[model samples]
Target: MTPRIHGGGDHLGVARWDFSSNANGCGPCPLVLRAVQEADPSHYPDPSYAALRSALAGLHGVEPARVLLAASASECIQRLTAWRWRAGDRRFWTPTYAYGDYAHAAAAWGLVRVKEPGLAQLAWLCDPGSPLGQGESPDAVRTLLNQTPRTVVLDRAYTPLRLKGDSALSAEQTDRVWQLWSPNKALGLTGVRAAYALAPLGAQPDVQTLESLAASWPIGAHGEAMLRAWTQPEVQGWVAASRATLTQWTQALSDMLVGRGWAWAPSEAAHGCAKPPHALDATALRARGIKLRDAASFGLPGWWRLSAQRPEALTALDTALNGLALEVAR
Candidate 1:
């Protein structure tokens, strides 16, 4: 198996000006933080997650039976892949650039990677996709959804973090594919580790099978609290309000980088990719308490993925780049 590459909080410890992970810069929402902190760890979450599932379903206006719980988004990816593979799915498709876990899980199941969506029994889609924050044309999404006997999972992890633009799939179209959501990123509490998926209409059997495959109590106390808090109206409001601040910060970061000769890849989401005028020395940047995600793993070797951060963090990044430039000049 290929080694997984990721950003944020590495062995070197968290960077002071980390532009790697795409967690909401304006959060750890106060509501979520309080919920997670006050969570009673003395007991395990209900093994079936009955209350949590119902709450999430109510939020999306779906039946509670359509909600499937997972320990995290990655867990859902792997579980969904395994569930389909067991049912004789031997081919999988992924976007040209996508979260590594999608492809990673498929590969582990010995599935062939099909270049075209029509040829695969299992497919993954991430809207406002990772690394680039771009999505397939709505027509393309419709085409994928229209295919029969294909297990299509649409990862909606970044939907809440979108600074602008709407999803490529409509509500009815979205209901046709499995919708995987991990709100910890939106709540800015990624460490909490909880996620759930809304199964396609009439996919209760698939949901049950996936649940049976899961370990009991996949979510613990804190994760349960965070997920429950995620369904609250106030928490949703907090996420909506953060997007405005994120937009301004994203624009500022783009302007600063472009002025310094970096070429920004237009993105509608909070994170984006850019290529430096010259090669980037990641090691040198980290030395100055800065970290950026190299886009090489996402098939863009010359670019880096950066998230919108607070102004102070942006200033620190600016200072770090200047230092690197001075050293290069010397």
Candidate 2:
């Protein structure tokens, strides 16, 4: 735990607990950092966002008008709040990790907050987790959505960027799926928070209002440039490399966990969401200078989420975990 400098990414130093996220280090893309400083995508200094939206819209199979790019998914949560009341102490959330801030935003909106071992109206779950990279079941999701219609807002972010199985909310459907995807998280453009929403496409006023608000206040110039660069062929090459790297790291990490007599999450579901929650003791890990997020936050105390972000991090984790005695795995 360190002072998050508004956005200074020092969560990298967490030898044990990676609270920040597993964005799998973005490599030399002709798209970011000094590249932006060098060349520019300002073919139209006052460009038409249509091109950007069109690209993402086509990818998601949505109309350009349905596409609304925002600074970050957090902005989407705020926009969601504009439609839904923000406070009254009456609301709902389910077990989750790494929600940018949707539940907190809902609470801020003033409503009767309801949480528990089982109070899941609007289940805020993530398949194939944030930092851990596990996947979950669509049937499970459908069940949750069936439990409560027009209430749930699932996060289907990592499902796309990384190569994966069928996402519970990736199709051209899923009305309850209000997915917020960030290239920064999966594709590694953390600075450029250009993300899109994959909610239901329809004549809903709520969605239209959110879309209009986003268009009028789009993701800005820097984000637009980052998106353009990421969409470039050279940059996409980086994504492919990153995916391969992740696959390798994931296998190594899984092997290490198994060798240590712990269960490695299956890849069938998406990030490790299908696997049951488990964790190592923080007090013992603290002895190793490994501070972990208590899984209790996501309903599994001290069991920090771990994903094979890259080869190096996975190696480090395997080494660290291997050094531990069998007692710690429990």
Candidate 3:
């Protein structure tokens, strides 16, 4: 049976205090916003995306040939899985609780989910991982890399939003596996779908094959503008500055949850998980313009994952929690 793909931002209409999605709370960086707004709508972006790819490659200190752009991280996951399936890979493995799309894509492509990393033809590793926001061990990464006849992709979507701790992989270690990045989250532009991947140093042939499977002009003008702005020094500086604010917010939110009898889950990133003392009336919270992600979809039942948001949002959440507590008391 195929697993369901669940995400934080659903079509339930926008919430006034949306702590469900992990997008940077401090951004839509001003510089990036302006760039995207100014993008020409009359003409198509250069079909090759040469300049944009080169900029991203330069930022990561990789060759332009190693860059693979996608419409979004989800799209990239599906495309990569399809490519692997076509290449006769039928076994997949994920090191920890991950975004739902990885498992969904594998199931859609008829790939068997494997328990052992070494036995799978394809593997996924996310540093400062989703839902729980914990980094992987370097030893585990080395073990996966040493596994023969395997293709490993490291999802780096949250790397930019990490508030504390560091990645387990060194530059040398990371170069041995595919690195997938989605700048939209860091820039607070999740509405704009754009992502890119850096292939392993000698995986040019594999990268070329994946590119061949993609549709013509995979990214539109606005996405092109967003990706282009992501490589700028000023935009990166803004993101770095925003982390300080997120750190403070995360600490405040954790303290609030603990005070209200919720069990705070340890995390190093800007987002974390917490288990409520009792089952929550999610529908009630939604009506109050508040949203928290149910972590059950990420494999942790009875827990919710929340992104660090502004003080106003936190206050709203506190009020909602109080109301729920009163309801339970009555």
Candidate 4:
């Protein structure tokens, strides 16, 4: 069976105002863009990726040996599941509504879904999780850790984009789980796919297993440049500044939606789900070059996940909703 497609972006060509994907609205960071453009594609990157790995490790204050790079977060998900299956894992669990790939990868590798976290061999957790943007509860994390699952992976793709709240896990607690990092979303360079994970401390054997399963040169020149840019202080500073802008935009968009009778789901991230006052024709909005993610796929029906965009884009969305309201009244 084919893997299911997940998330939203400019997949159907490009929308004039796209709120489907939760990428940083204020990026691609200028520094990251420059680095990608200057990256030389003529030569292959050092297969060992020593310098790049060290840079990332230094940024996170983790040992370079614990870092496992992949083509993207989705690829890492599949590869990790594959390795776990080979090691006799036969059940997977996701504590909350998750990215589709989590289930897809598990099923593809012959793992069945288990509702009870303690019974599962592999568990997936996303903080400031997608479609909803809420952080995982600390008590819940503690419970999961106490359960002692065979493997647990925490997807931190949205952590950097979180507009509010801290992670539920303490640093020491974080070291006990696989922390996956996908810098492209945070940098607004999603087109250049590259992601890395910091394996749990003392999981060197599992790290080695993952390394063997990986195809050499999993990341390309542009991806390497993007990941490299992610390690720079100035680039992170840019990301920090962008959050301020995103905060303002998020509030403005939420207010507009609320005023129009849409019910908003509270979120700590720059993106969130909101229910329209009435049903909306998604295709009609697409025709006008606007896109909003339907949340049914993420298990939230009657809602759409909208990313905060610039004021002009918000105005365009407001106008589109007004049109829909008018047609419904007619």
Candidate 5:
């Protein structure tokens, strides 16, 4: 069951941390804008977005051909879902999670979504377990891919997480791992709507079809422009700064928790891959005005996750959480 969202989020917006999302609190990256400035919808994306592919390929140490661009990681998944499954086919995933949209897409096309593995024909992996932002080691991930008989749809939305010691899948190394990178979370490209996928080195049967699915509707000129912005040097510096800022907030939240007599799980990446210390009762926190995210929705009931925010916002959150302790003690 969906844990109730305390205070019921208002439609347009609320304090965004409620979603366990990432943000720099620094708006509109100038570098991101410059990259987008080069976009020319008048001419289709340069036969094959060569420069864009080259930049990412060089970074990931993969040949340029292995990369595929899409509007977003979610869109990439939807395309993959279309290629592999059929009506009544079981789409397996862990529970209390994200990808509710993926489930809905499957249903619209007559695919069955199975939370547990009961005759599942296909499985999509959400690493670090959804809302909790946890990650499995590379070896652990390798094991799951090898063990699951169903075709694996790798959704590493939050994997390769954090600035220091991040772990992204190598597109060139693994065939089963079709990894996704969401600049929205990592790069704060929320409205930019640009994501890319990495697949096996073999000739792709799904490529044309996936491309068709992606291109069926026009790729907006503005979105294309925004994507180009992601490849700029100025943007890269901004990205680095944002990452550092995110790291700071993550540490602040952790320290505040410990000060409050709470503990957190071991984290690989600084901010994104952590679990609430075993005693952090997210459900209890909700009873106060804390507006905690339900990690239960992401397969872990006890943990809670928060996104990077302005220092002022963090201060407010600290006040709310401290008050929760007082209220709970009473």
Candidate 6:
């Protein structure tokens, strides 16, 4: 099995100035935080998650029956792949560069990777995509919808945290595909493992299969609370307001990097990739209590993906880079 490659706090512990994760730099929204903190762990969550599904469904203006819960986005990816495979999907498609889990899950099921979208039985799309933060083209999505893929899942993990531009797919187009949402990132509560998907219109049969395949009580009380809080108006408002601050921080971070001569791939989200003029020494940066996500795992070697961080974190990054430069000069 290929080891999963991900960013954020790792075995050594959290980075003091972590730029590895794409969680909302300004949050752990207070309201959501309170909900999670206050969650009672004395008992199990409702096995069926009825109220939670209704709330999530209402948030997206979909039927509650269209909701499918998962322990996390990655879990959903694995389960969905397994579901499709059991149903006889032998080929899958993913963007040229995308979340590792998509390919990982497919490989686990012995599904062949197909380059062309139409050749796939299962496909994954991430709008405001990771590593690049580029939005998918609506026309392309429309075209794909008209194709033969039995299951097309749009990972909306970054959509809530998008800093600029709108989602390319409109509501109607969105209704034609599965919309997988992981709010933990948007709420700055990545530690919380909770995610749900809105099944395509009239996908009840598919939903039933997915549900049957799910482990009972997939979400515990804390995850349940965090997700429930996500449907609240104030929590949404908090997330919306944080974007302004993140936008400012993003500009400052971009200016700092550009000034240092790094090649930037501008993103519409708080996080994006850039190639440092020289190959970075991950250990050296970690020694300085700072961390950056190397893009090699995402197939963009020599480039690093960084999220918009606070002024303090940016200054720390600058100092760390200077130290590296001095070492190179020596």
Give the candidate number with the greatest TM-score: 1
Compared with the true structure, all predictions reach lDDT values of 0.90, 0.54, 0.90, 0.88, 0.57, 0.91
Query: Best to worst by lDDT, what's the order?
Result: 6, 1, 3, 4, 5, 2
Measured against the true structure, the TM-scores of the candidates, in listed sequence, are 0.98, 0.70, 0.97, 0.96, 0.72, 0.98
Off by over 4 Å in 3: 1-4
- Model 2, which residues run further than 4 Å from truth? 1-20, 25-48, 86-90, 95-100, 112-125, 144-152, 161-164, 169-172, 204-208, 211-218, 233-237, 261-263, 267-294, 318-330
- Candidate 1 local Cα displacement, residue 80, angstroms: 0.3
For candidate 2, write residues 206-226 as lDDT tens digits. Answer: 556666555454666667766
Model 6: CA > 4 A from native: 147-149
Q: For model 6, how does the per-residue alpha-carbon lDDT over 1-330 read when each residue is reduced to its tens digit?
A: 445889899999999999999999998788999999999999988898999999998888888999999999999999999999999999988887798999999999999999788788898899999988889866567667885557889999999879899888888888888999999999999999999999999998899999999889999999999999999988889999999999999989899999999998979999999998887899999999999998888889999999999999999999999999999999
Which ten residues in a row are the worst by lDDT in model 2? 1-10
Candidate 4's residue-wise lDDT over 210-277, tens digit each? Answer: 99999999999999999999999999999989999999999998999899889999999999999987
| Candidate 3 lDDT for residue 27 | 79
User: Cα deviation in Å at residue 262, candidate 3?
Assistant: 0.8
lDDT of 3: 0.90
Lowest summed lDDT across 10 adjacent residues in model 5 is found at 1-10
| True-vs-predicted CA distance for residue 303, candidate 5, Å | 3.7
Q: Candidate 5 lDDT, tens digit per residue, 284-324? A: 54443344555554555666655546677667777766776
Clashes of each: 0, 37, 0, 0, 10, 0
| lDDT at 67, model 3 | 98
How far out, in Å, is residue 89 in model 5? 5.6
